[model samples]
Target: MRTLFFRSASPSPSNSPSRSTIPTSSPRHSFSDSLMEENIEMAQTLITKWDNSDVSSYTKLTSLFHDDRREAKEYLKCVRDLQSAMHHFVNSQDSSAEKLIISQNLMQSAMKRLEKEFYQILSENRENLDSETVSSRSSESRASTRSSVSDLESESEDELMVLDADQVSSIPMADLKSIADCMISAGYGKECVKIYKIIRKSIVDEGLYHLGVEKMSLSQVQKMDWNVLETKIKNWVNAVKVAVKTIFYGERLLCDHVFSSSDSIRESCFSEISKEAATTLFGFPELVAKCKKSPEKMFRTLDLYQAVADLWPEIESIFSFESTFAVRSLGVNSLIKLGEAVRGMLEDFESAIQKDQSKTPVPAGGIHPLTRYVMNYITFLTDYTEILADIFADYPLTLQTPLPEAYFGCYDVDESPISVRIAWLVLVLLCKLDGKAELYKDVALSYLFLANNLQYVVAKVRDSNLKYLLGDYWVGKHESKVQQYAGNYERMGWSKVYASLPENPTAEISSDQAKAYFKQFNAAFEEAYKKQSSWVVTDPKLRDELKVLVAKKVVPAYREFYEKHRVGLRRECGVDSLVRYAPENLNNYLSDLLYGASGGGSVSSSFSTTSSSHSRGR
Candidate 1:
């Protein structure tokens, strides 16, 4: 039988078959037992040879038992061989120098026999496991056998090292180095490593090897070839880089996939993936660069920004709050500023030019606020150069200045008085406060001054508008009706003044000044409203138009107050703060102020000559 032949060919032949040898008898489960017996016997022979420092023989014996077996025969063979080798070394006195040389020659003969058996088994195993489906399993089994051979070689190598250390401890450095180089070139890495380590330890113990290793390890030129070391380092970096990139892109794709799935399931999947990202890849610079490079594309592709908004807060607490916030907050701010500025400019220009009144006009870009935010985010990096440089090392190109994009698009606004005034305010703010110039105090002062001037302009306009509405009642109006009312109260006795008015004086006050000023303003408005009926009704169409205008104005008062509060309300009373106080009254005031003129006065024809002067005043 073929099995019997393989068993006979193996060293330390057993009364059975090898695993790779085909059985000539009827196939039966007992065949596995035969293979196991043969493998175990071969393992013992290989171990004996390995312990005796017969490396060539050890390698030969290892080849025999290295094949896949359903019964784990090959694995058992390897294990048994290691055990036998360990036992042989522990029991043998052949290690003594007087007996070592003679026994070593005998050990080599036994190893040569074992090597012949191993090669027969390995070659047969390789031939048998040559199927594609079995390739991986076959390769693994081969690797295990190779590793066992390596182990045997290591044992022989250790014996040599023990012999060398005893004999060459007093040898010159040059001889020791030559031995190292010889081992390295011979592909005896284990032997080389063991010997090198011992040599290093002995030299260090006596302090002789320091300069040599230093010259090798620390020398700038790396006297020995280091391409292997360099290749290994580069390969490691590339592998990690590839893994990181894959995860980043994969995470976004998964988020997108989950988003399109059922909402609850998607949310759960997204949350899990996001948490994983935080743990695994957050702060990886390469990923950050990729995301930043195509921020709009990145976000739009998977709505990653929105997903981050939903998930990052929870993740950030465990990761790094400041880092996450610094990136996202600046992004959000840039977007908000860009959107507001562009929208304000376009709308203001459109209104000024009556472009919206035309049949067709260009539409403003409808990119999401966050897209624009990303577009403008680089500025923040440049503006906070030191802080950013500490994190990123260099400023990104997107963040640089000089407005790479132009603002050449046309806008049509009539440049009316209101338009001119608003444009001036915007220009002032831009010139003063917008950018993060280091001149903080100067910028603050400039902003304060602009705010003060704006407040003054609004106040003068309001006063003039009120004067026109109050007619003769305000002809000699020296103070606010509230101040005037306070004076009247002082002139009268407190009790009399209190008695003359309603007990509670239920009057709405502006938020700017609570109860006292409100009562006075209420009284003034009531008086003006009562006198308003007497104004000429010449503009009947204007009255109807005013009715619609008044409604529209009051409806937006709530929104205006909200916006003003968000912006930080100015102290002076103007439409900005007025809406917060007596919204209805302010609405009425605006109506009467725009449409109702006190019957006491009208613009003379000469008023027309000064229209340009009023325009210049704006």
Candidate 2:
């Protein structure tokens, strides 16, 4: 550049106008014409020299940028010079047609070098240019790009670029930005963008692959064993989070910054790189949703639902561009399909509870298997409350009839649509349990079964997330029902024992009547204790409460009967045989009643009650 300008400025004897010929124009105009002629005639020295040599050797392509950043700056300058030459060839009248051809050729060579450099930088520094780091550090402008993971050795390589491969960073972000801007402004933006899309897209797809997200057809997912499918669902739950949080996020940051000169290019490149991977990533849950609906698959569906629902904001933000709308649509579509599957599963689950035809009553009047299964299932549903609340808002409960008025009573299902839906499911389970209680032969044992199952339901609601959704009103009401069931059990089971006593303990009867009454009491006590010894209460608190209740009713009445009549009877002969049970003996028998002895359906004589009929549950 200096040689061309200086030579044109120096005196040229032939062009000095010979001092004889009059000048046709001003001295300033004459000088400008001479300068333009010289530039047009000599040809650009820079583009010709690079065109004639091996660009890789002279530039040491990778090393030049990484080791000597000054060479990188010089390279951008050469791009600018070529652009200037092309602008002149297009606009200047005096420019030779051959110079325009040379500039075009030189521009292509420069663009090729930039493309290769861009690829190498992205490839070699994949980890360094990771999404987490890129998104976090990308907020800095070109002035501060050197301070990021790919820090610059020198900031002097123009505003957008300076490169060095060293400790923490491979090459500063500025280097890529500079190359992109140079090529874009030089009428080669399309080529730069194409190279960016290819390389960055591979990184995105590979990230998804490593994260275990795959594009699976419906048949492919359906053929998988449930255990295998569940594992994949869990992996996808983790993968979708990473893809949105860091992978797509970083790619978007890089794309926007590099191609910041053109909004259309940035949008188009990001969509091409990320949309497919993201669509596949999100489309997975919808596939899982299409699998055979079962009670077991409900939790998996909820997990998928939750994962997508959780990352939806980021998904929307990253895929907001019109070109990437399919990704957004797929994400939202997955959520919709997942919600539908869950609701369908809910209906099926309730029907299964209703149709349970198992005639075999739980032994010892313990908790029913259906009771545990339904409560456990609904309890898990509570963990998904916020999501389910939204889901149920759109699809309200669709039972043939509204919930029974007395079912929830004062509790308002309308407070939250999901709340009512869950409450309805639980009520359906309770109704099924009521029908199952009829299978028990003894009315007393049936009442005990209801008490045991209801106690379990109350505790489950009290202890878990159900307490919040169902509220204290529901729990308090159900708890009272449990107390009523236990009372009915006590009354029905012990009525005969109470009837054996006299209406008044102090009313004096004859000697023979007293002896007859004492014998009647002894036989009744033994028979009732033996019959009830196998009955069970699964909740410890409820079991203890029932014991205290029955004790209050039975012990006092019998104790008064014993004290009054036994004194007179003991005076006669054979008193020990007549009075078979003391008040202390009654207490021992009551302790042994619910805890079925090791021997099934049999009462141990010692009545220590060392074994339990049912395991205690919350």
Best by lDDT: 2
- The residue-level lDDT of candidate 1 at 261 comes to 26
Error of 1 at 485 (Å): 32
Q: List the pairs of residues colliding in candidate 2.
A: none
The TM-scores of all predictions, comma-separated, are 0.19, 0.86
- lDDT by residue for model 1 (1-618), tens: 666634433333453457748554432324433444444456555445344343555544443222212112333345434334434434554222433343343334443433343334323333222122122233344335434433433344345345332122211122222223322332332343333333222322222121111111223323323333333323333433332233323333322321332344333433443333333222222122222121112212122222233344433332233333443343344333333332343333323322111121111101112111211322211232222222222212221332111110112323232323333332333232222122224332222222222233223323443222222222233223323322322232122222323333333324544323334434544543454333222233434443354345333533343343423335545644343344445555545532333222212222222222322321
RMSD of each: 27.1, 6.7
**Which stretches in model 1 have alpha-carbon errors above 4 Å?**
1-67, 70-241, 244-429, 432-618
Question: Per-residue lDDT for 82 in model 2?
Answer: 64
Q: lDDT of candidate 2 vs native? A: 0.74
Per-residue lDDT for 413-434 in model 2, tens only?
Answer: 3457887888888898888889
Per model, how many backbone clashes are there? 8, 0
Error of 1 at 39 (Å): 11
Question: Candidate 1, 318: how far from true, in Å?
Answer: 20
